[model samples]
Target chain A: MELIVPILAAAVRSGTPILYATLGEIMTEKSGVLNLGLEGIMLIGAYVGFIVTYNTGSPFWGLVAAFFVGMAVNVVHAFLCISLKANQVICGLAMTMFGTGVSSLLGRGYVGETIAGLQAVALPGLSSFPVVGPVFFSQDVMVYISYLLVFVVWFLMYKTKFGLMIRAVGDSPLSAEAAGISVSAVRYASTLLGGGLVSLGGAYLTVVYSHMWVDLMTAGRGWIAVALVIFAIWNPLRAALGSYLFGGVEALQMRIQAGGTTVPAPLLMMLPYILTIAVLVVISVFKGRGRMLGAPSALGLPFYREERE
Target chain B: MRIKVEKRFYITKWQEVCIILASIVLAFSSGALVFHFLGVDPLEAYKMMIDGSLGDFYGVSETVAKTIPLIMCSLAVALSFTMVVWNIGAEGQFVLGALACTAFVRYLYVDNFVVMLACMGISALLAGGLWGAFAGFLKARWNVNEIITTLMMNYVAILLLQYFVYGSWRDPTSLGFPMTPLFPKSARLHQFFSTRVHSGIFFAVIIALILWIVVRKGVWGYEIRVSGQNPKAADYAGIRSTRNVILVMFLSGAIAGLAGMAEMAGLHRRLQPGFAVGYGYTAIIIAWLARLHPLAIIFVSFLFGALFVGGENLQIAMRLPLSSVQILQGLILFFLLGGEFFRNYRVSFISRKR
Candidate 1:
């Protein structure tokens, strides 16, 4: 039970960042803009969040700072892809390279520094419940917030007028523009919101999870979140579930390694990556029709308002 | 109140080329400014960069050696990206190809150098092509996003390398380091001169020239460009867009795979973690900066190779941080991308009403 609790605990903690990033990416994709800078944005968030927490000795401030930095990064992406209507993939990749390099250079001094991270905030009576309680209710505020964001995102995407506009723009920007909706505005807002959420995910890792600032500490999690968005078929709730499963695998690998199983550490490290590829392959096999998963029709295409010719 | 927008002019063909060149210069200037901010003399840095890349015959040779893989990978990326097929897993394909080609050279019972080189090249090409084809298949058949699939596969490929180097392929004589056993003398690529330049540079240039020729003259290339420009029109005209997507991806991946073989056979002589470095990732930048033109990729790849070699020299001689090169590269990319805005769209000022 002790081992099981720690494993579950690790799963939740490990999965939170991926959940955050995937949710953010899902929002952007829904608005017909693919933000490839999740890796860069998250790195900036992790570095800035760690620096702020280290200086302030408070994780909350770190989260706030990281969110703002993430928003700033997204705004740049929005300006390029939405406003300027440049190529989305190139812009995103450049953003990643720039973001990673800047963050690493700025974070060179804080390599091994530690900060006081958040602790589990379980409900009073609920904390004493069986496995179910520990697995779900007893967790960090970020994890709860992720759950809330899932429902909120789902509701906003499917229920609200803003959601409708977002969907309309994503499906057909030309038609949306003709219908009097501002495609650029919708795209810009979604991209910013997406960037903010992904940065919070980064903050969760540096301030609430690992509590240290290290160069490229987010490693490949940002990329994995991109994969998860596809695996979940752009559904926020499914994305959260996929992230938890990924976290569970990561948690299991750590446990196996700690138990001194015959498997080598390098091989164990490779397991999650391999699993990600496998899941992608399986998803491809099961994905009968392209539109069934609700992928945006004009995801990566740049919209040109004046190019009628 | 309705706002009257002025008519925007389309950038002329000549202006497009000029803007690209201007952006390149601006990118370099931006790089110099970054150096100035780091307390280094910008002029001295520029001189150092140029001199380091071509100061002596040896330096030129080293640049050539680095340029080989960059050229190959950039060509790979440029070819696929031109067809709207993003093969982000080129890095993984490169690793897997290197691993396969190296294994062939080491364990195979081939005595002839010609046969060994042929085997290695073919294996690398096949491996890379398969990796790309897998992504293309997923994209074409299931409508899965190739970007996510390709990117995820890169990690898996890296892990595969880690597994082999640390596990079954560990060099028995090296005691503890994670790497494969060195290939036999016969399997190694021939060096050109006193410096470490190899035959692989010739191969890269040849491949680039071949791609240029193919795209310029071949029926398939014409179909690809047409389909890429307008898939719906191609579909209406009875061209198989899916087939072109798969074929372009294969060709792209094959070039990157050859890059892996070049690293293993020409330079490294064995597989290691640092075998190819960031050549695959850097190639993405190179391809874009070149605008996915085969001829342009050839030149840009050499430029990047010079930057890499020169950056190392700057680090050793000028006491600048190694990451200075990356910062410079980033600045160039930023401005280059920003410059594209001017090419496609014009910023006009409207007088504000009081």
Candidate 2:
């Protein structure tokens, strides 16, 4: 009973980064552009976040810089995919390679450098509650932001006129175009904004989770987030559920490892990835034909305004 | 005047060559700019890269050695890519293959030269093929995304390799290094011309030729082409694409595994941490540049192999990181992808429909 609270609390903390990334990918996909470059964007964001915080001594600015720089890098993907109408998958893979290479090169000198990262701040009243408060409210600023972000995203995706347009563009760009929406504009907006949020996920890893820099530190968390996006069925609320579940498994793994279990660390490390595969299987099995129902109809397909059939 | 983008029909071979050349030139120019900012003279860096890879017989041979694994891995990836399976797990498959070969050689000591190599090779192929087939099975049965699954499995495979080499397999006598003891002389592959070059080159060449022939003339090749062109049509034609998916992935993985076995037996003679050098990832780039043609894979892999060796030289001669080569690679991919727009469509300014 006592262990559950800490595990949940740790789960929320661990899940926050993925939640942000999942949310970001949801928005991007909702607008019909699939950017598989989230892994690369996250790496750049982590590097920029770490370096900036180390230099300016302000983690907030570190995040802001990372976000914008991430958007700047995303511009290439946008240009190649949207403007050039190139293969989205290949472009995204290239973006990953580009981001990884650039970040590794730039971050070589800054390796192992520590910074005064974002600290935890518990809300007085909410934090005092037994289980929920500590797990949800009593955490660092990023965790708090992630919570607000979930609702904010849900609202934006479900309620707003812009949300309608984004989903409309994703579902059927031709109809959306006929109904007086600029398909390119909507895609560009979602892609850039979602890209910024994804960058924040990476920034959180450096500015909040760990205080020091390491190469390839994101360690497939970005990829895990990619899986989470699918598991969430593109819903922000479900994304929270999936992220927390993954986080709990991670926390439990660490707890078990800490308690001195006989299982090897490498084998333990495979748990999350294996869990991701298992979850995908379960989702596809249960969801059946509707497994990918929520996916944007125009996903991975380049929208060419001129090619009217 | 509004600009109109029109799809071009029947592009000339000259135009195709020019476009490919332009993409390369643009990529190199961007690479040079990166080198300039990194405080190295871009011109000198280019010269150094070329000379280091191709300057002498030794450099050429070294590049060939690196190219061996690259060719095999490229073919592995290209095979899956032909069916649009996106088997990015070749990295993991490669490491797993190497590990399986090591385990086989270690536990089952066979004195006969060819028999030992054959057993080790078969085990490696099975390990890698099964790893690939697992993803294929998931995709075939559950419609799972192979890209993410394959990519995720790579980390698991690499970690598994690390666990073995760093733990039980660590050599006891050699200053506690995280590698197995040297293989027996029979286990080591035959070298050529008193150099690091080995019979692996023949294996790579043979695989390339065999793949080329099979893809062009074999029954499975026709099925693969049909399925790739139109899955629905292929299905209607009674092509069991599900089986084909698993089969192609297995072969893809098996070839990648063979590359691992060759690297371990021919070059290193023992599994080490250095065995997981991003050849699988680099091979994807080769596959893309070669347009997934089996013969072209060999040529492209050789070029990339040169770039890798040159990167090593740059690391030694100048205090530059090898990641600079990675950056160049990224630029090439970006340019190549961007150039895809040109091949498919052409934009021209026609006076606004008046």
Candidate 3:
């Protein structure tokens, strides 16, 4: 019983970064573009976030810089996948490599740097609550923003005209075009927005959680976020649950180690990835491929408006 | 003014060649810009890269050594990609294969050279193939996304290797290093005349040729093509797509595993840290650059192997980071994808209509 609060709080803390990435990916995938380069994008964000915060002593600017740089990197993906109609999967991989390479090159001089990062703020009315107070309300400001973002994204994806256009373009570009919507514009915006949010997710890892930078420090969390998109069935609400569950697993791994068990570090590190595959298998079995699971119909496919029959 | 993009039914073979050449040129020029930004003279850096990787016999020999694994991995990736099944787990499969071969050498070493080599080769192929077939099995059975499964397995595979190397497999005699003891003399692959080159080149070349034939001329090759382009149609025609997926994944992983085994037995001679150096990911770029053609894959892999060596040279000579190789790869792929689009679609500028 005593271990419960710390574990739950750590779960929320650990999962917030992935939650941000998952939400961003939902928007990206909802608009029918698969950005598999989240790892590279997140790394770029982590690097930039740490660098900017280290130099300027403000994580807010650090996050803003990371977001912009990430979008700038993703624009190439947008141009290639949308305008040139190149292979989406391959182009996404290229983006990953580029972001990884560029960030590493630029970040070489900034290794071992640290910054005073964001501090936790207990929510005004919610801090006195029983178990939920310490678990959810007392976190860095970014976590609160993420909580707001879930609903904002949910509302944006389901409530607005732009959201309708994104869904239409993702499912059937020709139909959206016939309805007087610009498929290219919507896709470019969605991708740019998605890419920015993904970077923010990366920033959260550095500026909120770790307070420092490391090379490829997001590990496979970006990939985990991508998988969580499948588990969430493309819904914002479910993404939170899935992210926390993953976070709980990771937190447990850390806590078990802190408790000084005999298990090897590498074996424990393998748990999240193994669990990713396991949960993926379960979700895939129940979902039975994409269409039933509400996957974007044109996911990973290029849209060519000129030649369609 | 506006540009109108139109689909062209056919492009001349010469034009296709030109597009490919242009993409390579653009990638190099852009890479030069990066060098310039880094305060290095672009031309001098390029020259040094060329000279360091291909100028001397020693450089060329190392290039050849690197090309061997690239060729094997390229073929492994190209084979599965030919059928549109993404085997992103080649890196993992490669590591898994090396680990398996190490187990053979560690526990079941024999005095005979051929027997040791055969045991290593067989174990690697089976281990890697089964690991790959595991993903293929999930994909074929429940329709799990192979990309995520394969990608996740990569992390798991690397961690698994770390467990072995850092834990039980640590050499006791070598100052507590995280490596198994060096194999007996019989276990080493035969090298060429005083060069770093080993018999792994033969394995790479033979596999490339065999895969080229198997993919191009065989009946199963036709089925593979059909299944990739249109699975529903293949299913209607009574092609067991699931069986094909598993079989192809097995072969794909088997070849990659062989690459891993050869890398250890021929080059390193012991399983150690830094064993998986991303030849698997580089092989993806190689396969794509070659358009999945086995012969072309060899040619491209050779060039990438040179780049790999050249990047190493840059770090030593020009004080450039080795990540330059990854950047170059990304640039080349971007240009290639864009070039392919231009190849199939002709864009012409026209004044905006009033």
Q: What is the DockQ of each candidate?
A: 0.52, 0.71, 0.80
Q: Judge candidate 3 against the unseen true structure and give its global Cα lDDT, from 0 to 1.
A: 0.89
Looking at candidate 3 chain A, the ten consecutive residues that score lowest on lDDT are: A287-296
| DockQ class, candidate 2 | medium
TM-score of each model, paired residue for residue: 0.92, 0.97, 0.98
TM-score of 3: 0.98
* Residue ranges of candidate 2 with Cα displaced over 4 Å: A289-291, B38-40, B351-354
lDDT ranking from best to worst? 3, 2, 1
> Candidate 3, residues B1-354: lDDT per residue as tens digits?
988888898999899899999999999999889768856688988887899889999999989999999998889888889889999888998998999999998889898999989999999999989989999999999888888988899899999999999999888887988998997888889889888899989999999899889899998988998999998899999999899999988998999999999999899988898878789999999999898999998899989989988988988998777787788888998999999999989989999887
- Badly placed stretches (over 4 Å) of model 3 are B38-41, B351-354
By TM-score, rank the candidates, best first.
Answer: 3, 2, 1
iRMSD, all candidates: 2.4, 1.3, 1.2
Q: Could you tell me how far off, in angstroms, the CA of residue B351 lies in candidate 2 after the best superposition?
A: 5.1
Q: Model 3 clash tally?
A: 0
Model 3: lDDT of residue B189: 95
Model 1 chain B is weakest, by summed lDDT over 10 consecutive residues, at B1-10
- Name the lDDT value of residue B154 in candidate 2: 94
Candidates 1 and 3, the one with greater TM-score:
3
- Return the clash pairs for model 2, or none: none
lDDT of 1 by residue, B1-354 (tens): 334333446768798888788887887887677667656788988798889998888778888889899999999988888777888878988997898897787678388889999999999999988888888887777666788778877877788788888888888988899888888877889987556888898889899899888876788778888887888888998999887788888888888898999889999898888775678888998998888888888788888999888988887888665566766766677667777877766666666776
Across residues A1-309, which tens digit of lDDT does each residue of candidate 1 receive?
977987987897899999999999999988999888888889889988898989988888989999988988888789878766778888888778777767776777677889887878996786678986888779888888888999999999999999999888998899999999999999999999999999888888889888888777887888889888888988998998899899999999989988988887777887777778778878877877455458889898778877553
Residue B19 accuracy (lDDT) in model 2: 87
Candidate 3 local Cα displacement, residue B292, angstroms: 0.3
